[model samples]
Target: MAGILVVNERYFPDDELEPAQVGATSFSRSALRCLWNAGLSAGVILYKRAEELTEPQIDLTHRSGFRCATLRFNFDMGADTVSRAIAEAAARLCAAYGFSSRAMLYYQTDALLVFHPQELACCVTHHGPFVHDFVETFSARETAQAFGDAAKALHLFKHQELGVNSVRSNGRMFVLQHSQLQREYLISRGVDERRIRAIRPPIAPPTVSEPLRDERLRSFVEGAELLVFTAVARLDYFKNVELLVSGCVQARKQGVPLRILVVGDSAEDDVARQALRAHVPEELSAEFMAVGKLTKSQLYALFSLARSNGIFVCPSRYETLGITPLEAALSGVCTLMTDSEKVEARRFFPDAHRFLPSGDGLADAIGLAYASPSGVEQLGKELREAIATEISEENFERDTLSAWSYFSQSARQLDS
Candidate 1:
């Protein structure tokens, strides 16, 4: 019998599977580990959509450590619309893999948009900020319409063999939400409440770093009294990275010393980066530094350096579950984030600093901290202890198994 099939865009590259990869990659690895620990057969399908790639191929390395199968397929498709992209990719996958009915289909965020498989128990892990993205970027009416379209497009999955047309109406696969607010948002958007389950991901303890070795990082941290701020995220609008730059500009205008290091996949010539550079005044340009991707060791060094008089900011406008801020808190850095209701920042972290997603608001928050960092520093220690206690590895293991158990039970019923 086929075991669980994990489908995602990027299958944690073999060399980068360390705990430092603590976003979607970490969750993917954790899910696989959970399934493996449960003694169930499992495999992974790393699907990469391409326009010229000829055929699907199996990756030998993906199945190296785990005694499971792994297939690397390329789908010829355009990035026109997210839904269409997903549907086309799903079609290619179904054609290539002849997916069995008994196998549990677990889809990451990208595959969940429009690929609703018929029969064959499937589950979706919500990782992005769909509703929040719409509301923040568009209007409420647009958000509602977008949610309605998604619901209508992906909700119904037929169980033809079982003579059940209302599988979705009942509980078609489990919809694992990263947060209670996210699950509630899905329910509000007409998804069956029975099919939705909110399972906060298990966060591993932050990896400890050796003493700071990089001289450049050391200089950046100790060079100035500038309140060092570090942000890690994609250079996307919803990530609200521009706000961090805007905040730095605002702080500089107020004669406050501040320096920010943005670490992510931001290229020098990227549109967003270019726009930000042009917008910032020449005088304030030195206040911000955009470092593209860095190794895990480098990241740990930065986090360690920021432990004193520095803060990690996650100014994202929408988040299913903000992992970076939690990770920052774990690393003993004073973490500041947006006060997004959907993210429920306070619910998970009562002590971490928060601000509204605006240039002025972010600047004020940072300014206050810069003036009196004692409270922010104390908050970091509190947050570290809180995360270690609340998200203990033992608790995460138990929760992950419980989540799988619930889905497995639902899958069994479908086979019945």
Candidate 2:
């Protein structure tokens, strides 16, 4: 029987792991769950901070019947050098344990740096590979200048060029695109049509059949003299949180009563936080609150506290079926998102539901949601229904099986 090696640079969730130490993104956590549920013997390899590693270790583990391997790395080296080290380390680990070519390697994101491109299948979960193309959607040149430098612009271009080349050279490239808009973007960027497989990231069932909206949360919002709009994501550049901050100022000037609560953080959070602080006007200083990262239970509690017209905005500049907006929708929070070609919000909702990652555009979307609260809430309800009907567990299972079958057959054909 063939097994799979799931490679993601960040930590993957092992239920046995402590909540405080679970560092996987919500999307990655869901994808890992879906893979395990599909009956694949998945061995997850992830990194640990230098401090988190007491010794070099590899362990065979199982979670709810799914067998996996945990390869913990000590992050004493810089990324560029460490990537090659991790790749060579992984190959040695596999060789020592007999993980073979019959066992396909799966990347959770467009991260091909850790392994030989021809030895694994990778998923493009964002538009980093096509940043130039995405930049055009939000007015690339001006946005770059607004973001503050030429080096950043050059990096975007370089990343796209190198990333596309990497994709083209890979054994297989999975584009997690749910719409024609997303699929076309990948094809235009040089991803081989034959090697591309479009799949939606799975949405796990909520921990509760019905979320208990904390009454104290409602009272606190009412007492604070603010209306809350919640967003959850790693504090990263592609999240376009700086633009969201600018738009909030614009919305407040327009007499819209709004404040933002940001959840999630990263080592890069300080950079993003500083940029947001610089954008905030003196009068609106307290209008934005970033609580940094939260536990999964805490996140669900926040979701439960969402009012009928409360909004959840995903200001990401790009995505591969961004799962946060869907989580918000499922939580019954009205959702507004950026016009990411791969975001499922665009796949399921009308154009009115999306905004560009520009100050004026995002302000307008928020103002509109504010203007017609009932309509916005109804739309959120419809989005939730659509997710349940269109992206069900059964659908996820079928898609998982289909992707596995394709890879398995292709591998056999090559061997024959």
lDDT of each: 0.59, 0.58
At residue 96, what lDDT does model 2 achieve? 48
Candidate 1 lDDT trough over 10 residues, lowest sum: 156-165
**What TM-score would candidate 1 get against the native?**
0.76
lDDT of 1 by residue, 1-416 (tens): 23354555444565552333335776666777766676654456555555455543444233436433333334332233433333333444444345433455566653432334444566667565554434555665544444455453233211121212222453646676667766665665566776666665666644667666657656767665655465554665456777887887887788777776677653353555566567678876666566554555566667776777677787776566777677677778777777877554446666337787788988887887777746556667776887677754566667766766677786677668
**lDDT tens digits, residues 116-191, model 2?**
3344444444423245655666576655653456677776566556656776665554544444555676687767
- Candidate 2 clashes: the total is 0
Q: List residue ranges in candidate 1 displaced over 4 A.
A: 1-5, 9-11, 17-22, 50-64, 67-102, 110-119, 131-172, 211-214, 266-271, 342-346, 373-376
Cα misplacement distance, residue 135 of candidate 2 (Å) = 6.2
- On the 0 to 100 scale, the lDDT of residue 205 in model 2 is 45
Stretches off by above 4 angstroms in model 2 are 1-3, 13-24, 47-101, 117-186, 205-219, 222-226, 266-288, 340-345, 356-358, 373-376
TM per candidate: 0.76, 0.71
* Winning model by lDDT: 1
The positional error of residue 364 in candidate 1, measured at the CA in angstroms, is 1.8
Q: By TM-score, how accurate is candidate 2?
A: 0.71
